[model samples]
Target: MRQPRPRPRLLPLTPRRLPLTAALAALGGLAGCISGDGGTPPDTAPPAVHLQQPAEGQELAQPALQVVGFIRDDRGVQRAEYSLNGGPPQPVALTPNPDGSRSFGFQAALAEGANRLRVVAYDAAGNAGAAERRVTYRPPPPLPAAVEIDPSAFAGGWWDRYGPTYDSNPALADHGVSHTHLYGNDAGYVEYAFTLDRPPGTALATLRARLSSNFPGWSGPADGESDVTVYLNGKEQGTRRVMADNGSGGEYRFALAPADFVAGRNVLRLEVKSGSAKKNGLAIYYRALLPGFVDTPISIAFSAQPLPSFTLEPLYAPGAAAFAIAQGADALYYFKINRQNGFDVPAQNFESTGFTGSILGTDLNRVKVTFRKDLSSGDRLAVVVQAGPQAPLGEHAFWAEGRGGGVGSSPAAVNLRVVACSSGCR
Candidate 1:
C-alpha cells in the first residue's frame, strides 16, 4: 500500500507581558467569556497508527523481524516507537531514503508460538497513535547435499551428446558454424560415442536421441547432417540418417526392425557434419522404451515423460474461466464465476488425481481458481492456463471438445472444441 504524507499542525498563541491597564482589561475579558454562556470545546480526534509488514498470523523463519509502517494525522508525524508483546516501548527514528519513503527497522528475537508486534506514533504535543500484528515464528529447514558434474569426467559413447552442437558451441574454424564434437582444427568430424548395458535377451526396440539448440537470443537456421549406427555384441546392426528442420531443432527418432537389433552389450555412435551454423547448443540422450520386461541393463535418460495428475482451486474471486492447454498432461475443474457464460477460472496446478480430500484443512477439492493479479468487480478476463512439464518433450492437451467450443474460442463461444492427445499421454 501507498499512502499520502501528513500535513503540519499549528501552535496556539500565548499572551504574556502586558501593562497593568492592559492586563486588567484582558483579565476582565477572560472572566466574562468564561462566565457567559460559553459552549464546551469540541472533542479532539485521536491520532491513527497503521502497520505494513509481517501481516497478521504470518509465519516467520528468522528471529529478527523488520517492522515497517507510517503515521497519519491532521498534523505530520512527530515521533514513533515500537514494542514487542507488552514489554517497554522504545522510540524509533524515521529516516527517508532516496525513493521518498520513510522506514524504520528493529532487531529482536521472537519466542516460539504466537508473538505480538506493535508500533506507536506520537505528535508534537505527545498525542499517541498505535497499531500491531501477531505473527508465528518457526525455524528454517536443513539444506540438501551438494552435487557436482565435470564435463571432462564423463566417459563412454554418450560423451558426444554433451559435446558441441551446431547451435551451441560451434567450430571456431568454420566461421561460427554449428558442429558436433570439438576435435582439433586439423580434424574435420566430431564423434559422439556412448556405451549401453544391454541385457542378454533384450533386443533393441527404439533408439531415441535428445538434443537442444542455442540459448539466449542466438537462434537461427543451421545445415547439419548426422549418421547414427548401432552395434550389438561388437557387431554393426543398423544405421540411419538424422532428420533436420529448416529452422527449428528436433529430436531424432529411429525404430529398429527385428533383424537390426540384438541382445547384450550395445554401442551407439553419431557422426555429425555441419555446412553452416550459428551460436547454438546441443545435447543428446538415448532412451530405450521397454514394457513389462523389467530386467534391462542399459539406463536411458530422456526428458519427455508423462506428468502426474493434479487439482486446482480458485481463491479470492468468482468467475468462469478457460485454460488454454498448450502441452503436457493436465486435469481441469469447472466452477461458476459469473452468471454470464458461467464464469470459471483455471485453478492452480495440482499433482493429485482426486480433489476429494481437504487441503490445509480447507475443502479445496472443487475447481477453485485464484487470479495471478487482481480483477475488477465486474470485469471478466480471458486467461490462458497450463500446468505441466516444461516445453518440447512431454505429451498431453486438454480442452472442452464440441460442447464447449472449437479449439479457437473458449468452449462457451465455439462449437466442437477438439482435444488432441499425443505420445507419452497417460
Candidate 2:
C-alpha cells in the first residue's frame, strides 16, 4: 500500500482594505458628526467631503478620469487626498470656492473593470472625513461594414480577366486609335464589400487589387494618371495617382497588411476623381479584391533522385531584357535536373496551381511550374518566375526547392535571379 501524503500548509493572508464608508464609520467614535440642526460646537465636528464628478456607478469610455468636489470646515480645510482601487494616495490641490469654502480637483488614469475611488479631507484640528465613488471604463468594439458587391460588376470590353488575357491588345485598337474606358470632369464611382474573419489570427492571407489605364497618343498633361481614391468602411486608406506603365497598359496593384485589417465584414469604394478631356480615359483590366490561400503549399522540387550537387544560371525569355518581369508577366524558368534516384515529382495542373519562393524576407514573384521527370543532368522541371507585381525595378534573387527524395536521398534547392520590369517599359 502507498503511504498517504501530508496536507500542505497554508500561508497567512494579508488584510483586505475596508470600504471608505466602513473605514470612516470605524473612526466615528473618535470624531463627532456635524450637528443635525447645524448647531455643532466649532471644535467638535470634523471636516465634510463630497464628490462632484462621475457620480457613483458611472460608466466611461475614456480612461482619464477627473475627480472634483468641495471640502469645508469652520476652521478651514487643511488638505485633501485620494486613491483608486486601494492604490497609494495622491495629494489633490485645493482652490478657494466662491461660497467661502474650499474646492479640490485632480485627474487620474483608471484601469479596466470596476474602480473604487476614495477621497479624504482633513481640518486644521486633525479631524478627518471620507467619501467614495465607483466607476467603470471600457472601450467600444471596432465597426465593420456589413455589405458586399458581386465580382462580375466590373466586367466589360475595356477590362479583362487577371490572367494572360489581361495583357494589352494593340490590335483591338482601330487604326492606331487608343482603346480606353473614359472618365473625366465627373467622378466615376464603384463600391464593393467583403467579410473577413474574426478571432485575431490569419483569416485572409492575401488581399489584392490589380488595375491599369490607357493613354492616348497625345502628350496629355504633366501628372499623367487620374486620382483614384480608396476607402475602407467610410475612412480614407490611400490615394493612387494611377496611369498606365508608359502610354501602354501596365498593371498597378495596391496591398494591405493582413493582420491590421478588421475582422468580419468590410467595405471598399473606388472613385475616379474628375479629370481633363485630354487625359482621363483608362483601359481598365483585371481589377479585383481577392483573398488567397497562403499556407497551402504543395511539395515541389527538381526531381525524385539521388541529386548530385551542381550550380545553375538565371533562365529568362528573349523579350525579358527589354520588358523585364512586369506586372502580370508570366515567366517559365527552364531547369535541367538529373533525377538518378526515385520519383518525387507531383503531377502538374498549370492553369490551376501557382508556385512561390522567398529571397531574404521578400516573397519571390513566381506563378506555376508544369514540368516532369527526365533523368538527365539539369534536364527536368523548370522553375517559373513572375516579376513582382508590387516590387520595384531591380535585380531580385530567390531559391527554388525541389521534392525531397526518400530512401537516403535529400531534397534540392537552387538559387536563381530575375530582373524586375523597369519603370521605363511601356
Candidate 3:
C-alpha cells in the first residue's frame, strides 16, 4: 500500500477550562436554582402515580371494589384521595417509603354500569398528580328454575356437643322415625349436600317441615316447643320456633333465598334446640324445596272453590264429572284416564293415538286425555268430564302428568266414581 501519506503526528489532548462565573452558573442550574439563603428549592412538579390494581378497562362483577397503587415525587408525598363516578373525594391509606414515595390503598363501591375512578396524590409542595381508570360493573345472573333435595339424599353428619349438635338421626327416638325427623333435649344439626345448575340468588325457595310433638302418644301434660335454625352452606338463613300443638302434624313453610346456594355442590343445615318436653323436645321433619320442574297436582276439588291438597271424598256423579285442579307452577298437564274394577272408558269419547282437538285417548287404564294449561302463582283450573252414552257407569281414576320448561313433575292421582244418568249422557 502507498505510504499512508505521512500520518499526522499524534498529540495528547488537554481539558478546556471555563471562567469562574460560568462554572458557578452551570452548578446552580443542576441544583434547580437554590434560594438566595442556600435553602432547597420548592417542588413545583406534581406527584408521579403508578396504579397497580383494577387495571384500565377492567370488568368487575361485584359492587365492592378495592383500589391500590403507589405515588412518587422528588419531595415526600403528603396525602392521597380517590373519587368514583364523580362522587365526593374519599381519603386513602398511605404507607411511606425511604425514597420519598408512598403506597396508597382505598375501597370504593362501584355503580351498576360504567364507572370512572380517579386517584389523586399530593406532595409536600401541594402539587397533585392524578391517575384515572374506567371500569364496568355487572350484576349476578338469576337463579335456576327449580330444585328439590329429598330426605334420602342426606347422609350422616357431624355431632357437636350441644350448642348445636350435628346429629345423624335427630328424630330416631320419636319411635316412628320416617324421613329426617328430629326430637330431643339435645341441640343438634343435620346437613344435606346438593348440587345446583346455577348460583342460588335471592329467588324464593321453600322448606316443607312438620313441627309437632307429643309425650309418646299423649303422655306429657303440656305441648312442647322447639327452636330451629336454618343455614345454607355456612351462612345463617333464618330461625323459627315451632309448636307441637297441632295433632294432625301440620306442615309449616319457611321462605328461603336462593342466593344462599352455590352453583355446584352445597350444604343445607338445620340446627334444632332442645325443648322442654317430658319425652320429646322439638319434633321437626323438614325437606328443602327449590323451584325447578314440578308436574303434580297441588289440589283437586269437585266444586268451583279450591280445596286443600290431598283432600278426598266419596264421589257419586251422574252423566258428567266436573272438577278443578291446582298446581304450583305454569305447565301443560296430561290426564291419564283409567278404569276402576272392570269399568271401561267409552271408545267413542277419545282418540287412540294422535290428540287433535285437546288430546283425548282411551284404552281402559292406558287411555291418555285432557291437555290443559296450568297457571303458576297458586292458580287453579276447572275440568269437566262428560261420559259418552256408550260408556259404562262405575268408578274411575285419573292422574295428571305435568311438563313445562323442558322439565316434568310426577303425576298425581285423581279418582272419580261415575253413576248412571237416568236421562242418558253425551
Candidate 4:
C-alpha cells in the first residue's frame, strides 16, 4: 500500500467585493503547497536474497560447484555477486524472472575441506543483503594394488583314511619351500580347504596353482595314470591332465565366476586316479586320490571394490566345546571352567598364559588349520588345566587355535590338581 501524497491548495475569492488581504493570504498558501518541500524518504533497506542451489550440509565428490538462486526487494535490485571463502566478490550471470524477480547462476572452483559460499544481492540505492552456505568435499577411497591368497598353505587339512598321506614335499625346486604333491606306491583321497571373506562387490576370482602328477609305470593304459580331475567345494571344475614333464610340474591358472563363490568361503580339490585298488590292475583315482594329483600353491587373486567395513566369520562350526572353546571369534575363543550355579557362564579369551580358565574337552580338531598368518610354523596350542579338591574330580578339554596359522599338535597334556584346604575345612 502506498502513502497518500499532499495536494496543492486553491485560492479563496469574495462573492461581492474583492478582498486583497484574503486573496493575498490564499495566494501565499497556494504558492507554499506548489513549491513542495516535503516528500517520502528514499528506499534505504537492503535487497533480500534467496539461495536455491547447493543445499546446506551436502556431501560432494567433485571440486566444481554450481550456485543458483534469485534476488528480491521492494526497490529495484541492481546486481548479484558471489564469493568463495570471503575472497573478493565477483558478479554472476543474472536473468530477469517473469514475476519481476532476478535469477542468477554461476560455476566456481571448490577446494578440499570446508568452503564458505556467500551470495549477495544489491539494490540501485547501494543497500545490500546476503545468504551463506557451508559446504564440504571428500575424496573416495583408493583401489587395492592386488588381493592374493595361497591354497597349498592349507594342504594336509584332511585326507581319506584309505589313501596315502597328503603332505608337502620339499626340494621340488630351488625355492626350498614345500609343495603338496602325489608321490606314493598306492592309490586314495586327499582334500584341500580354502576360504575368503566378504568381498566389496562382485569380483572375478581366480586360482593359480603349481601342479604335477606321477604313476608307478603300471602295466595298464600307459597314459591314463597322469590325468587328474578337479573339484571346487565338491562341484567339478573340470579335469585337466597334468603333464608330469618327468615330475617337474608346471604352473596352472584358472578363473572362477562370482556365482561360483559364496560371501565367505570356498574349497578346491584335485583328484588323481593312478594306482587302482585292484592291485593286479586298477586306475587308482589316487589310482588312490582320484588317479594322480599334485598341487603347489603359488598365488590366488580377486578383483574387488573398496568397502567401508567388513567382518570375517568362519564357514565351518562342526564340533562343540565346553567353555570359551564352545564359542569361536575372529581373534579369540571363550569358555567357563566351572559353571556358576543359577548363573550364565561368561566366555573369554586367553591372557597369554594362565589357569582356572575353566575350558574343558577338545573339538577344535575339526577345524582346518593353516600356518601363521605371516606363514611361519605349525605348533599346536597347549591346554593347561588347574584343578583343586573343592573342584570336580576330573575335567576334559577341547581346543582350537585362539590365533590363526599352520596346524600343529600340543607339546604336552595337562591334568594337575591344586587342592586348597582351610582351617574350617571338613
Candidate 5:
C-alpha cells in the first residue's frame, strides 16, 4: 500500500446530520417569513353528503329501514347515526357496499303514527353532514269473504234462493225456481227450455248448462253432434256445437247483456240433435252481477251411468265419487246411505239437498262438484244415463220423487242426474 497523497481530510455526513441540516433550513425559512417573505395560505374543502332512499314525506310499509348516502373526499367515512321519531340516535357501520353506495340498516321499532328519520354521517377528517325525511306507517287492511256455492240445491226446475248461511251449506234456500226440461224422440234430437225469475235491480251476466251425457239411443253411424242456440227474450243471441263421441258432452256458456234480463222474468231455449238414440239431459246454472243474488243458480253439475255400449250401473255407494258423463268434462256426486228414511225424494223437489255444484253452458257436457261434507255409506243414488230433446208442441210434465232416512251428516248427500222424456213423456 503505497501512501497515496494524503486525501483531502473529508468527513462523512450521516443521516442524522442530514436531518439537522434540513431543520436549519426550516428555521431560516421561518426567519424569512418574519421578514414578510411567506406564500399564500392553503385552500381547504368541506366534505359533502346526500340521501338516496325514502324521499321526503314518503310512506314506508316494510319493517327494515335502509339509510343510504354518499360522501366526497378520501377522508374515509367514519361513523353513521340514525334516529326515528326524534328518538336517541343509533350508531351504524360505515361499510361500503359492493354497489358503490354506503348503507346503514338497523332493526328499529318506530312509533305507530308519523315518524321523522334523521341520518348523520361523519368522516375521518371530522367533517360531518346530515339528512332527514318524514314517513308515515300504517297497518294492513282486513280480508274479504271467499266466493262459493252449493251444487246439490242446483237440481229440480229451479233453485230456491236463501240467505248466506255459515252452515256447511253456504247457499240460501230456494227463493225462486228455475225450470229446465228435456224432451226428445227416438231419433236422438232433444229440446230444452227454461224460465228464470230475474230479481229487481239484478243484472244477469252468464247462463250455463251442463248435460249428463252425450246424445244417446241414436242408430246413425255418424258421431252424434248437439247444437245449442241461445235466445234472449225470444231473440237469437248465439249458437255453438257440442260433440258427444269425441268425449265432449254438452256445455253452453254464454254472456248475457243487462237488457237481456228483465226485472221479472227471462226465458232460455236450447235445441239438441243426435245421430242415434236421444239419450242426454241438462243441468242449468246462472250467474248474476250482484253479489248474494240468492235466486240465481251458482253451480249445476250432473252424473250419468255408462250408456249406449257399457251397461255399467251407476255407482250409488254413499261417498264421494267422480263420474265422466262427457268427454273432457266430469261431474262429482256425493251420496250418503242410511237405514232410516230421513231424505224425502219425490217425483220432484231435488233442490233441498246441500250439494255445491257448477255447470258450464258452452256444451253442457261437464259438471264440477265441490262438497262441504262427505256422504254416508250404502246410500242409493239415481243418476241419469241419457236424455234428448223433443217438440215444443206437446204437454209433458217431468218430475222426480224419493224418500229416505238415516244418521245424516251436515251436508247430507249430493246427487246429479239427467231426465229424459219420450213422446208424451215430459
Candidate 6:
C-alpha cells in the first residue's frame, strides 16, 4: 500500500493592477518611441538618393543645369533642397513614387570650374539624407579661321580617253577654246594636282569656280547645262548637272569633304560629260576655302608619258590649188599631217614663213604654226593666219622652212587668194 500524500496548503489568488499615474506614464513612454504622425513606427534610417541625369563628375557646358535624381526614405519624404557651391539651399518639389519613394529636380547655378553640389532630403521625423556630386563647367574654344587656297597653285592638264593632250601649268586660267566632251562617246576631263598641309577635320570645304556647259540652246533644262563629275585623289566625290545663263561663263561651287584631302599629293579632277560634241570651257578665279589648313607647294607639269622626238611630213595631199581668205580675217587652219605619214611615232617640227604685208600698211608679217598630236584621233598642224583691214587683194605664194627631224617643207609653196568681204570683215 502506498502512503497517503500530505495535503498542500492552497494560497489565495491575488489580482494586482498598476497605479493610474504609473500606467499613464508607461503608455506615454511607448508613444514617445513611435512616430507622432498617424501611429507609424519611428523612422531612424536616413534617406537614400540616386542620380538619374548629369552623371557624377560630368562636365557641363551650361551653368544652369538641372540635376535629376530620386530620394527614398523609410518614412515619407517631407521636403528636399539643393545647395550649390555651399550657397544657400533652395527648396525643391518632391514627387511621390509608386515604390514609396520620391524624386526631386533642381536647376543648379554652377560657376565656372569644378562645383560641389549637395542635395538633401528630410523625412517627417527630421532625419536628413544627402547626395553629393562634383561637376565641372568649361566654355568651348574658338573655331579655327578658314584658309583659302590660291588658284594658281594647282597643276596638271586637260585629259581625254586617249590621254593628256594639252599641258596647262599652274592650272588656273581662262580657256575660251573648243574642248572635247568628257561624257558620252566623246569623253574628256581636266585634272588638277595640289597638296595640303593638314586635313579640314569635320569642317566642310568650299570650292568655287566659273565654268560653262557649252550647251547652246534655250534657257531651259538643257541650256547652259553641263554634267560635271568631281573627283578627289582618283576617288569620285560628287556629280552635278549645272546650268549657266551667261555665255562668258557660269559660277559653280562644290563642297569638298575634309577626308578627301591628304597631307601630301592630292588630285582634283573635273570630268565633263555631254551627249553633243560641243565645246565646254572652264574659267579661272576659283576659290578653295579650307578650314585649318596650310597650302603645300607642288607642281605637276606636262603629260604622264611624253613621246620621243621624230620627223614631220604631210598626212594628206593638198586638196585645193589655193585657199581663199577675206581681208582682216583671223583664222586658224589645220592640215592633216604627221611624221613618217602614219601614227607609228610621235613627232614635232619648227615651221617658218616669209610673207610681209609692210607695203599694204598692215602688220601681217608673222604667222604662228603649231602641231596637235592625238594618237586616237589623227595628228595635224595648225596655222594661224591674220590679215589686216587694208590687206592686199591678190594671189600670193609662200614657202615654209622646216627645221629638225631632217625634213623640209613639202609641195614648194601654199597658195593664198585674198578677197574683199561682201558685208563686214571677221
Whole-model lDDT per candidate: 0.38, 0.49, 0.49, 0.46, 0.38, 0.51
* Model 6: per-residue Cα lDDT at residue 20: 62
lDDT of 2 by residue, 211-250 (tens): 3443334244434555666655566656666665432244
- For this target, which candidate reaches the highest lDDT against the unseen true structure? 6
What lDDT, from 0 to 1, does candidate 4 have? 0.46
User: How well does candidate 5 score on lDDT at residue 411?
Assistant: 17
lDDT of 4 by residue, 1-426 (tens): 999999987545554245776677778767776775444467889987776556688666556776766777887788888999989999877766534567666778888889989998888889999999888876543322333434324354322223343343343333422333443332333455655565323444565655544333323333333445556667766555554432334666665544565445666655654443222111111111222444334455666422111111212123422122213322221111221123221122222323221222111222222222121112222223322112222232222223211111111112222122222111
lDDT of 6 by residue, 1-426 (tens): 999999998544433244665676777777776646336565788878665545589776557666766777776788888888999989988766445667555576779999998889888888998888999987433323444434444455553323333223222223322221112112356666665655544344566555555422223334434567778788777776655433234456676665567766678876665453442433332332233322221122211111223332322223333334457667444444333433243345343333232212223544566554532234555556676343343433333323333222222223334443221221
Off by over 4 Å in 4: 1-40, 150-426
**What TM-score, computed on C-alpha atoms, does each candidate reach?**
0.27, 0.36, 0.31, 0.33, 0.30, 0.42
Model 6, residue 24: displacement in angstroms? 8.9
TM-score of 1: 0.27
In angstroms, give how far residue 222 of model 1 lies from its true place: 20
Q: What does candidate 6 score in Cα RMSD to the true structure?
A: 37.4
Which parts of model 1 are misplaced by more than 4 Å? 1-45, 75-77, 95-113, 147-426
Judged by TM-score, which candidate is best? 6
Q: Rank the candidates by TM-score, best first.
A: 6, 2, 4, 3, 5, 1
How does residue 326 of candidate 4 score in lDDT? Answer: 19
Each candidate: how many clashes?
35, 10, 11, 43, 72, 4
Off by over 4 Å in 5: 1-47, 61-66, 97-112, 147-426
**Candidate 6 segments exceeding 4 Å error:** 1-42, 56-66, 83-101, 104-117, 133-141, 161-200, 204-211, 215-224, 231-235, 248-255, 258-269, 273-426
Which lDDT tens digits does candidate 3 get at residues 1-426?
776678787534433244655666677766655534545656799988777556699776567665766778876788888899899998888866434456665678999999999999888788999999999987656545555544334544432232212123435334543333333343556666766777644345666655554323334445655566777778887877666653324556665655566778877776664442222344444332223312221110111111112212232324344432222211122223322223222223222222111111121222233323332222222234322112233334333333222121122345434343222221
